[model samples]
Target: MAGITGIGSGIDIDSIVKASVAAERAPKDAQLARLTTKTTTQITSLGSFKSALSEFQTAADGLNDASLFGTRKASSSDATRLTASAEKTALTGTYRVEVEQLASASKIASGSLTGDSNLAFASGGKLTIGLGADSFDVDVAAGATLKEVRDAINTQLNEKGISANIISDPANGTSQLVLSSNKTGAGNDLTLAASGADLQGLVTNRPAALSEAQNAKFKIDGLSLESATNAVSGAIEGVTFTLVKAEEGVSTTLTVGENTTAVKDSLKKFVDAYNKLITTTNSLTSFTKVGESGEPLTGALLGDSTVRNVLNGLRSELSNTAAGQGGDPFRALADLGITTQKDGKLAIDDTKLTAALEDNFDAVGSFITGDNGLMNRLSDRVDGYVKSGGVLEQRISGLQKTDADIKEQKADLETRVAAIQARLYSQYNAMDSLIGQLTRTSDSLGSALSNLPGVVRERS
Candidate 1:
């Protein structure tokens, strides 16, 4: 196949073989090309479609929560003095809150010692400190300085809500060791006891406390209440009051009510997501023409039954009214001012939605998120197509398999074309060799006859 093929016959064997191979491979090559293009486009299109559906499903799931409706918003008239927060279980009402006192932590300072902070104590001993219901002991070494004692106390008891430090009064040439309790409340006061002369001096000769531990005392609606910490909870169901400062003679109003804004925002998000999904589907299935030639451009998913079915399923869910809302004023998304447009997109009526929520907030939740609700149904329907091993995945996988098959066919075609080209070249080379032999044989016979003295030679 690689020899000087056309020399004997004066024919282009390489060119002929190339043409035959092209002729043999053209049809299958074109078919495979078309198949590959189409299959790749469809896989990409289905991927886009699935992504859009997932977004819409996520939006639906977010709104399909019963707690969203039960959410409560709490506000305080004087947030500077008192701030309140409420959970879903909090009853909606107005209460007058008065912050009489805020809880404080205890701070005590030892009598000033006329020496450097690093001065050694008279003798080492066991020092005990108590906070709340917990206590710890620090063993001071025989020659421990004031700083060492402070360090040992801090190292041993810092995590227990107690700290010790030396307050150096350089102007008076004295240093006072101060102990403070981070734990607030009267019952959590810090107590100190020591066993050696130097340690006992710190405890027995302590000055008046800078501040005493006290519980926060406040009143809600003229009902007295006290809390060990300023952040008071459980006094009111599902409500927490953080007492910031004392307003003994004045009261701030605490307002607990339904969080309609959250519900409205969630509904708006769902509508937006649904509308976006519609837009995506429409684009993916659209067919249009462009340019002066008016060449038709088609979408990858055009005429696809899966796309049609998915859209129809979602539409059905959106249109149907949820059951079990017998006496409820709202039973569907339409009743809550969410309606479908002609183009299969959703539109919101802000005024109508606000009025609906204000009038029947609970019923609105029931219609959209309760048993057999629209969002729940829509979510379930979407799951059928988008979940693992679902319709979209199966279809895309089939298309991918088809694409793979096309590739294999193309490879097979290439191999066959190579064989055909080789065979054509071999046949052409053999014919050329035969022609060369015949010409050589004729020349030899003519020369022998001429030389044998009986052959006539004539000029044409």
Candidate 2:
């Protein structure tokens, strides 16, 4: 079998050096495998930690997971802490309220007014006509400036929630400032008056022209209490509302909840990570070498007890219960569908793993995430190894140092070996060249002797 081939025509110093390099890296690969396994284990352990944290939040452990997700509810100013239980919260309350409907007097109160236009201008007395937008009392005095009327209208509109403006005939310069109510209904009644007397014509319009109604409703605790417009004070808390209709009321009940999604997600994420680590670790042993090369799995960590011990510790820690607790995180690897065989190798039981997770999530959560949580310990281990002076870091540092030293030693040796090979090649080439020159010289001498037969006979 062609195990390996080289580009060089023959064995040389370069080939020897290449072989040495390959040998050195074989051991380095072993070290790399161990690190990879450790990293995978540490990562899985941390994942288990977070899952436990999620379970803690789900129970009445009282740390609302909603706050962790950024939707913690605002505390109301009047919020009272109630001794509410899950059982008690589900029960609804029955409410009762009473109200008075026919409270308004049977008769409509009435008033009237007349303006300066009805009598004469230049009269000193002014009629004060109040408008609805405000308590704007218009001064309808004879020869009184229009500006005064406008000011009164504006003031009344601002104060009384009424509107007043002049509707003037542009052609005649006669303007009647009108009044209207800001609200609906006859409650916004119109009134008229005169201050300097003789302007009593402003009140000349009698009460005969108007009719009005009084409206009322009742509500209790935000629900329609009933149609009570007026009530003796103090029924429910400090709130006594004027109910316009028995038909309309606000919702009296509210529902409060917490979102455990983040906590759930955090837990789920940890499970996935743990599973992935197991898968990856198992792959290290699973890979079959059925190819022509048939190289054995020869990583430095292939048979290291360190890797086995780490795995054992992780499983042991998880199987341990929290302090003062009755049960272990897991009853057995089999509970999680993980098992150890005759050869002491780990095996996965997917069905068992699923069952364990489904039954008793809190137990599983605590098992993985609690103070004595598996994840915390795993993260601690991973963090230690990954840090600047941790195991992985230290290992890598050592490898680099070894590589540097090896390179230096190899370089010095290569120089010496190259010099020897060069000398050997030079001596061989010189010997071959010398042999060729001598053969040519002999051939020339023999040819010269043949050509000169008489001289050749004398020499013979």
**TM-score per candidate, chains pooled:** 0.87, 0.40
Q: Candidate 2: list runs displaced more than 4 Å.
A: 1-254, 257-259, 287-300, 322-371, 381-383, 405-421, 451-460
lDDT of 2 by residue, 1-460 (tens): 1222222223343455445555645565566556556555444443343333233223312222223333212111111211111121222222233333423411211122223223243565554544333344455556554445545556745565544454445565444534444333334455555565444433444343232324344444445432212432343332222322222323222222222334444545544444544554454334456678887654334454544554565556445444325445464334555565554444555555556654554455554554454555555434443445765455555655655665565566557555655554554445555666777798999888878846645454
Q: Model 2 lDDT vs. the true structure?
A: 0.43
Q: How close is candidate 2 to the true structure, as a TM-score?
A: 0.40
Candidate 2, residue 246: the lDDT equals 29
Candidate 1 lDDT, tens digit per residue, 1-460?
A: 5767789888888888888888888888888889889999889989999999998999999999999998998899888998988999999899999989899999888777878778787678998887767788889988899999999988888888889999888798888788998888878877777888877767766888888999999998999988999998999899998999896879999998888889988888898888888888888899898987887898888898988988898888777765645787876678778898889899999999999887887888878886577788889989989999999999989998998898888888878887887788888899999998999899999888887866567767
lDDT of 1 at 193: 79
Cand. 1 TM to true fold: 0.87
The number of the candidate with the highest lDDT is: 1
